[model samples]
Target: MPSQYRPQLLGWIDDLDKGTNYLSGADDRLLYANDNYCAFLRKTSSDQIFYLCISFICIIGSLFLIPSLIYSLPSCNNKAIYFLLLAGLVCSILILYVMIPELYQNLFTRKGCPIIFNRKTNKVYINESY
Candidate 1:
């Protein structure tokens, strides 16, 4: 149904009725629909490759600090210094292992993202990059 109060020159979706959006196919944005739920793909960033390159550059720049971190490695005979260095190493490894993989997840988000809407709960669920 056409909106009775649509704005002039503005493409605002004033029509709350859902009877017109029936298109659904692989090439269409509408992915699925049920009695109380539906999903549609959203447009992603236009510069994904640019951001991916920047992400790689940032990762490489962060790695330059690794050499400096190991520069103060203690001699094998100093127990206190050795234990401190060991602890630092363990902490660094744990941090990197837990966080670095999260950076790769958004590299391809430019393709598309599915946003789900649930009428039963009147809520929306968005997919996180991580």
Candidate 2:
């Protein structure tokens, strides 16, 4: 049997793989799933997955902006912009907290292999160990 940490870490990796599969396989449906799908589906539901993906993208983008924002803060001389950046950072942190768990659950709750998609090549792979 795997150690506690090993399973948890593997679960996270599986979730990432499953998330990638969802993104590439059913792109349109996942993107435009209606209220029914969002409300009813468990684990890798459209909204949760989409939010997780968006949160990651936003976090990466925010990291790039952090340095510039910090450097310009003093010269900005504008309280509003500073407040906006602070608010954005807080929101991004919150999103990360919410989405990461959901992503992990979505990936590891199932018994089958973790599914991954290569968007560039539009190919799918199943990772059984996960």
Candidate 3:
């Protein structure tokens, strides 16, 4: 293929492998179905995943700290520190028990992917098709 056509040819091949995308294959009805595009259905979905991971760490850390907190309470002789540690443990437990399920529902229960088209600039973007 000519050098100028090489990029377009490669793009076509890539689109074919990707199955369906707004920028390429599968016709109008299937334009919204692409693995890469579908993975990122919501713009903030990735951010939410990151937050969930961080929250998991917080829960684990608090669990491990409970023993240390109890060990320190006698030596430190501070009721406030003990209560604060207890509160942290409770809050972390609440987040795990409550927020984790909610996050799963909100993040994973999306119905379908959406293909976004910009009218003025004629640009296209894909979102979760849920």
Off by over 4 Å in 3: 1-40, 43-45, 66-76, 102-130
In model 2, where is the ten-residue run with the lowest total lDDT? 32-41
- Please say which candidate is ahead in lDDT: 1 or 2: 1
Please tell me which predicted candidate would have the highest lDDT against the true structure: 1
User: Which candidate order results from sorting by lDDT in descending order?
Assistant: 1, 3, 2
TM-score of each: 0.40, 0.37, 0.35
Q: List the candidate numbers ranked by TM-score, top first.
A: 1, 2, 3
| lDDT of model number 1 | 0.54
* Clashes (N, CA, C under 3 Å) per candidate: 0, 0, 8
Worst 10-residue stretch by lDDT in candidate 1?
Answer: 6-15
Mark the regions of model 2 whose C-alpha exceeds 4 Å error after superposition.
1-75, 111-130
lDDT of 2: 0.48
Candidate 1 per-residue C-alpha lDDT over 14-112 given as tens digits, one digit per residue, 9 for 90 to 100: 122257743233344555566666666553343445655665665565466455457767445688877777777666666556446635755645244
lDDT of candidate 2 over 14-92, digit per residue (tens): 4546434543333222222221211111234555567557756755665666566566666766789888877765665
* Maximum-TM-score candidate: 1
